[model samples]
Target: MNAHPLAPIPDADVDAFWRDGVICLRGLFDADWIEHMRAAVEDDLAHPGPLAREYATQAGQRFLGDIGAWAVKPGLRKYVEESPAAEIAARMLRSRKVNFLYDQLFVKEPGTAAVTPWHQDGPYWPVQGDQILSIWLALDDVTVQSSGVEYIKGSHRWGREFRPIHFGGDTEAYKMLPGETLPDIDAIRREPGSGGLEIVNWDMKAGDCLLHHSMTVHGAPGNASSTQRRRAYATRWTGDDVVYAPRNGQASITIDKPTIQPGEPIDCAVFPRLWPRPQDSSLA
Candidate 1:
């Protein structure tokens, strides 16, 4: 499989990423990668990793989540290192280099009614930087009825990190960084004269993906479709500005503590450098 994007990322898409804090790039990944992820997702469902979770849901519904699969799953590791994802992230972030931070899986079985609450991805990690983001690759066709994620357009420029939302887990390890409390988004929408807070989502195909800022407030409804499954593979990537800064109450996703010191570039064994290939000494 070619490890490069089938088409060059257009300048408009890059502008959208910076202006709106999110962009849905279509047909970026070839069919080969999508099938590989589908197989990996099935295997992960059967034998979940340490951080795998079965979130609370109503009867006949299932919401499964897992993180840091790249550390143990060869398929995911290959995708991170060999796919055009790193290049895409670097271009979107406008950074000269990039690093593979981690990967997460969100599987909402048909009829699942577990809603992902509104929250930002920035505060959930033990790092800090404006260049951090995630590429959410759909493993199956996705629609609003099938739990397609919705993003608060331009929320990343809000310049504030809301408290992380806890979804029925051991909250002991999940602590909040210094930030504003999460606003009642639903209530705000119900009231009049509310600031025009727009939410955006799209119908996505198996090979399409959404690139979103780390601070973009986003969430998704349950898999309301009775027969369609909603499975997505979200890979987090960091650019040159990101650094390791372990914090208390962070998401329990880092399988092992990074060997790098606080305030150091996240370029240790856990988060390896991806861009500027060693062979391409010219770029380096």
Candidate 2:
């Protein structure tokens, strides 16, 4: 197969993304796209369908929710299935084939004190390997005070599996292994740029995005900023080589009774290929 020669992914950026397992892409989507997605999010919030309960939180509080493609609001269909976002994921994975792992919305309400536990996205996911990628798009400005994402540099290479926790709130019920609590938040704050730990708070505009590998260790503190609302749309994708692997103790949410056995190809519709760069075209 001929490799499509698209615009070169910046060497520095690619190296950082591969080494640390995350890369922040500034102003990737334009204002129009951002507005469109924002509208979709609003619609979902207003009408919130069946899957809405999965994402719903108490009124006047921050929460995390997911609406599967089939259950997504009509306004979000195009963005969920085929959008500039999916195209970017396809390119980043360097795969002619791509799959939709899922779409999630992370909302940090003003004064919300919930913190996301430090964990790798891969452990919770059914797919294995480094084929997975996650795109986090901010719907509103994200600042450090508002509790934006902070990643552990090069933690993807740690190669040790940390316990998976509930995505929405802190809990020890899902801790599959003996895991240590993350170091003091205040200490982490003191050494923001120390020890090769490149902590990033984009304080991003609506269209800015952060792409990270599935194995990258990341977490966000509570939203303390009273001014800005920290809302984000996160989409995950997998490349050609990813396969289903049922964890011994974990329950599967997206799959039914584990159709994908360990070491089996992930051929389910939930994760369908979305894009393939033009092979013979001259777009590059």
Name the candidate that leads on lDDT: 1
TM-score of 2: 0.81
Give the deviation of candidate 1 from the true structure as CA RMSD: 2.4
Model 2 ranges off by over 4 Å: 1-8, 49-59, 67-70, 168-172, 175-198, 248-261, 277-284
Q: Write the per-residue lDDT of candidate 2 for residues 9-48, one digit (tens) a residue.
A: 5668766778778887875565666787777777766665
TM-score of each: 0.94, 0.81
The pairs that clash in candidate 2 are 55-65
Q: What residue pairs clash in candidate 1, if any at all?
A: 175-249
Model 1: per-residue Cα lDDT over 62-113, one tens digit each: 7988889778888877787888898899999999999888889999999888
Off by over 4 Å in 1: 169-176, 192-195, 280-284
What lDDT would candidate 2 get against the real structure?
0.68
RMSD (CA, Å), each prediction: 2.4, 4.8
Please, what is the whole-model Cα lDDT of each candidate in the order they appear?
Answer: 0.86, 0.68
- Evaluate residue 134 in candidate 2 and report its C-alpha lDDT on the 0 to 100 scale: 92
